[model samples]
Target: MSTFTKPNHIGRKISRIRELRNMKQEALAQALGTNQQAVSILENSETIDEDKLIAIAKVLGVTVEAIKSFSEEGMINYFNTFNESDNNFNHYNTCTFNPLDKLVESFEENKKLYERLLKAEQDKIEYLEKLLKGK
Candidate 1:
């Protein structure tokens, strides 16, 4: 039997990318025609086979190398380097105007709209009660 080597920091990168893509494990599994538990295990750095890794990379829209390129120190150093950069404001400005930001803003607006709808329903119920009591 062949031994499986655990990927270095790929798990963290996969988790981060999944979040960035706004994907649930179940959704990703569906995209890959697999099961959520398998996706969870992959994200959590549990034992995984190469075929699973390839499927995940395809579903995540990233190269397998991109997923596997992360070293423990490399991950930390890359993030730290970005943290130390003075261009964060510029980067944030660019990201704020991205299509993803529009989607996020739209989602927030929908949430608010749903909240208002619920409140209106409650108010209507109260009004109907007052009318029934002739108040």
Candidate 2:
């Protein structure tokens, strides 16, 4: 016998994935062309029909196998990873530096340069007015 444990509660797994996706029973029911009461009954059961499971998976934007193997630990890990990213906006897995941060920095520098150029123009206009008055 294998020591690995598998999640077998298909209905509860579907419910959990739906909840994680921020979906309500009524919304899921609407997508599945069923009523909320029927969805409730399905979620409360241990097994679900394969056809219904396929429909539910499509509605939930997940695979049928994912629904069958969904676990609380996996959900928790996903949230933890998401929260870590939420806490640090600069952290992106694809690159060592955030391009958005660089863009914002470049924008600030350009803003300062534009302000300086505008001030210089104003100073030139003031000097021209002063010279005109003295002439």
Q: List, in order, the clash count of every candidate structure.
A: 0, 0
lDDT, model 2, position 118: 100
Q: Each prediction's TM-score against the native? A: 0.44, 0.56
User: For candidate 2, which ten residues in a row score worst on lDDT?
Assistant: 85-94
Runs of candidate 2 with Cα error greater than 4 angstroms are 1-7, 81-135
Among residues 3 or more apart in sequence or in different chains, the pairs in candidate 2 whose N, CA or C atoms overlap within 3 Å are none
Position 85, candidate 2: lDDT = 82
Residue 132 Cα positional deviation in candidate 2, in Å, after optimal superposition: 35
Candidate 2 C-alpha error for residue 115, in Å: 20
Report the Cα lDDT for candidate 1.
Answer: 0.80
> Which candidate number maximizes lDDT?
2
